[model samples]
Target: MDAGTELEDHFRRVYAGNVEAILAYAVRRVEQPEDAADVVAEVFLVAWRRSRELPPDDEVRLWLYGVARRVLANHHRGGVRRERLGERLRQRLTAVTGGDPAGEVPERLAVRAALARLPQPDREVLMLTAWEGLQPREVAEVLGVSSAVVRTRLSRARARLRELAGDELTEPGHVLDVMTVPAPEEGR
Candidate 1:
């Protein structure tokens, strides 16, 4: 029949023939099952788009393997990049807070516990201010709210954190102390 029908038929046949092998290849390579599933989906998407360019007969399976290999490589590189970025952020936070960068500092544990206890909205406002160094107005912009709303949320979040964590929540060297301290009111 038509060119579109021919292409769809070919794509369906290729998918039926190779999806399992591609999935197996991905599962063996990736740590997470979801990641393997993503790899398989991406490989088939590429095949569908470049169906005309697919090799004849059994060569198609080898070509699919090559595509899967590249996808896995990209996935690995992204994971590594994320890990490095997280490490650098940890180092910066450690320098600023004057706490051990390792995960076992007692003050850090207290702060984390207190933060985790807060509602998500309050927690996000505090994190944006303390960790990201965003001002109330900047946080408002990021969160699609008014600056006044952000300030109110920040104040309430601080109060809640103190309530949950007690007055002696963090040491002077903690990032929470530096960032969560009350600010002077705007416009006298």
Candidate 2:
């Protein structure tokens, strides 16, 4: 067999042997099953990338467990970072709007309700562009689709949102306008 075939066979054997144990290890550690799945995928990705350096079958499972441990640690750190960022955003919004950021504004509530009523794909596409501030091309990468498809979904989603939230949805910025908090007047 060629060197590439040998490497593939070795990687396959290692994967088959340890995938279940790694998944179980992650499932027990992570709060959500989806997070556990992500951990397992990251572990296997590291294994694939370092296939040549992997030890014999007897030791590969232990190696994977080590990789999973680090991956879990990184996942935890990421969660903490996102939480901190959200808190900072809330604080900034409160400072600028001069209102309780935790309280839902009627416009925001209406927009959220309308978004929730949308199909998951449409809602995701819209939020990714408007809320996450990603362009259609970037959203396409996140959703694993062509940019053209993302643009089409965004257009349709906006139209549906307008139908659901008549008069509230406006021109120039659509979802972004509804979602943006107006700054307090200087005198106030």
lDDT of 2 by residue, 1-188 (tens): 99999999999999898899999999999999999999999999999999899988998898898999999999999999999989877776677767565554776788888889999999999888876778899999999999999999999998888778767556655655776555533441
For model 1, give the 10-residue run with minimal summed lDDT. 179-188
Local error of candidate 1 at residue 41 (angstroms) = 5.5
Q: Candidate 2: what lDDT?
A: 0.85
Clash number by candidate, in order? 0, 0
lDDT of 1 by residue, 114-178 (tens): 88989999999999998777899999999999999999999998878766765554554344763
Itemize residue pairs with steric clashes in candidate 2: none
**Model 2: lDDT of residue 121:** 98
- Measured on C-alpha atoms, candidate 1 has an lDDT of 0.83
lDDT of each: 0.83, 0.85
User: Which consecutive 10 residues in model 2 have the weakest lDDT in total?
Assistant: 179-188
Task: For candidate 2, give the lDDT of residue 60.
Answer: 88
TM-score of 1: 0.56
